[model samples]
Target: MYDTLKDTYQLFEEIGRGRFGTILRAFCPVSAESVAVKIIDKSLLTDETDRACLEKEPKIMTLLSPHPNILKIHNVFETEDSMAMVLELCEPETLYDKIAHRPLPEPEAAGLMKQLLGAIAHCHRMGVVHRDLKPENVLFDSRNNLKLADFGSAEWSGEGGSMEGVVGTPYYVAPEVLMGRLYNEKVDVWSAGVMLYIMLGGIPPFYGETATEIFEAVLRGNLRFPPKVFRGVSPAAKDLLRKMMCRDVSRRLSAEQALRHPWILSGGEANPMD
Candidate 1:
């Protein structure tokens, strides 16, 4: 058991909170470095299952520590009252917030996609699958550099790892996972495709008033690309999207292959935000 801090970490404010807990900005006393502290309430973790999941996050963070594009976890400590995780502090908003403000320019969107793919590829190489890959989970540093965060739903695929449990945001989940089919790293690639589509087209490819309708559309595997909205979107771009979002996991392009697609390689002047 860990002792509770007499007072909250100074020099920051409470920025966000969710069902799990709250996130606050704090300065490291030793390095004077700024970071985000995720505080998980011990009281909320009433079962062994919840405790196991909480403990797994730190282990996964350690495995992913070396990746440049992934968020860096500096420390994990348990107080009598809460479990605190110190993470590198990101900037004012997430990718989701940025898109909500305005659609991304073509170059900017492509650049972000490239960065995210680099991160995902690194995780795959390490035998970890980020079950949840969505715009909301991607954050930006003060320099506007992208960092992948939120590994609460992540799982390892290496020897002795379990793949059970239905997880991931509906908008970005691959068909295989939705259908209860066994899946692998390709699921991340599918979610990446959905994210890229939203970045380029200004809205998700599939949206419905209800969750059932959205899942039905996803299962159908027909993602419409409106040329008018996605004006100047290259054929290569469309092709890559189709390959990544394929219903059949085996048919989808791997993250590495998608990174090298002609559309991604070709530098064009078209800006989606224009």
Candidate 2:
């Protein structure tokens, strides 16, 4: 199998690594382009959740794909020891890295949010929910187009529209999720709202030195914008943020509704004055 993989694509050095696999740069002779090959060692999948995600990711990506913002998966290969996924090669830097430098201007942040919500909307429409929606999962291409990646934590919401599990990052997890209640696709909206807050404020709205403290803050559900941090952010943008991050799931904005927000429709130009 290793020899077959070697013969199939011109695999290069490892570009990234995680607990389950290493991402390698490779050239696909068939496609005549560079691609990222994620090779997951089956032996390392120690937990049921991890194993399920490995099986589900490829199928979910295939079902919800062909969207501009979602990362494109080209092919899949498997063997007794490992599974390899051929994917579009994106820039090494993630949105997390980009925001670490400085807060993005409204227009720039709006552009990214537009792409993100579009992808989320598509995912929900396909009955898939991306439980993890952090900036680290968002990638950029050479042309600077946003590509939403990493569906390892995603789940199929199905017709029931409710799922149980305490999954997601502390800073971005929704209140209902923290309470161990059944949650739906709105979990992604809460996470995206947290991303927008970080993009505009350069810090997560809910913060603490420890994960427990962060979780506590999240449960408290106090949404605020410090004057110094949010003075320059437009009111329209803030309104959308509030809607997205609302603790009450019923009041939270769906990705489709968020797309129609004046701030988004105008590319962050609506109500420019704070």
Candidate 3:
């Protein structure tokens, strides 16, 4: 399958690889455009459910069209043996990779966070809940604008269908989600809070050697503020984090509320130097 289309797209080199597939930087000769093509192994489509989910992606991407902060899907096709998706190629790196290098300055963090929240707010308004909202899934365009990617875990909420599957990166999963309790858009807010924490402190509030330990830590709701590392984290920022990361999903801040938080909307911009 890939062998035939291989000639159509000039594959340069491997950009990323994951459990599902490999992404390559490629050029569409006919359109003279560059795109990141993700090639999924046919063998991975072992069951009917997997195939259904894989087929659903193109539909979901079509539904999310024209969003400024979301990666755009140009096309999807399948050969006799493989499936491929053409997507917008984002440059530089992911927010996760960036934070791993250094803590983002407060004003810069707030600006990026604002764009992320706006993107999620747009998703919620469209009745879509991006169940996975971790730093790794947030990509940065050339101008450093945030573009939410990897919608494999996203679920449409308007049709009255609710998500029951255990999804999302373990570090960012909300307590309610871990507890197996029914949840809503608030789950994304909790994940966003975790992202905010990483931006300020350059690490997650909870960490452990193993996945189980991390889950246990999250269940305990033990959030520590490393003031030494996050010297300039303001009171408003801390207050906002507390509200968004609340254990009880019912008390978690909504996207709109978080956007309007004093820290985000304050007359003065955040200053990391403070």
Best-performing candidate as measured by lDDT: 2
Model 3 earns a TM-score of 0.90
Each prediction's TM-score versus the true structure: 0.90, 0.97, 0.90
Ten residues in sequence with the least summed lDDT for candidate 1: 1-10
**Which segments of model 1 are wrong by more than 4 Å?**
1-11, 46-49, 79-81, 160-162, 267-274
1-274 in candidate 1: lDDT tens per residue? 2233214345368887967798888876667678888889978987776787788888898888967789999878786667888888998688998887556766777788888988998888888999899999999988888999998888887674336556888788887787876678888999999998888788888887787887777888788988788776766667778998988777888888877866565532442322
Which pairs of residues collide in candidate 2? none
lDDT of 2 at 229: 91
Q: Please tell me which model should have the higher lDDT, number 1 or number 2.
A: 2
Tens digits of lDDT, candidate 2, 183-261: 9999999999999999999989999999999999999989999999999888888899999999989989999999998
Put the candidates in TM-score order, highest first: 2, 1, 3
Stretch of 10 with least lDDT, candidate 3:
265-274
Which regions of candidate 2 are displaced past 4 Å?
272-274
* Steric clash pairs (candidate 3): none
Model 3: per-residue lDDT, tens digit, 29-71? 9999988988888787778767776777777777887788888
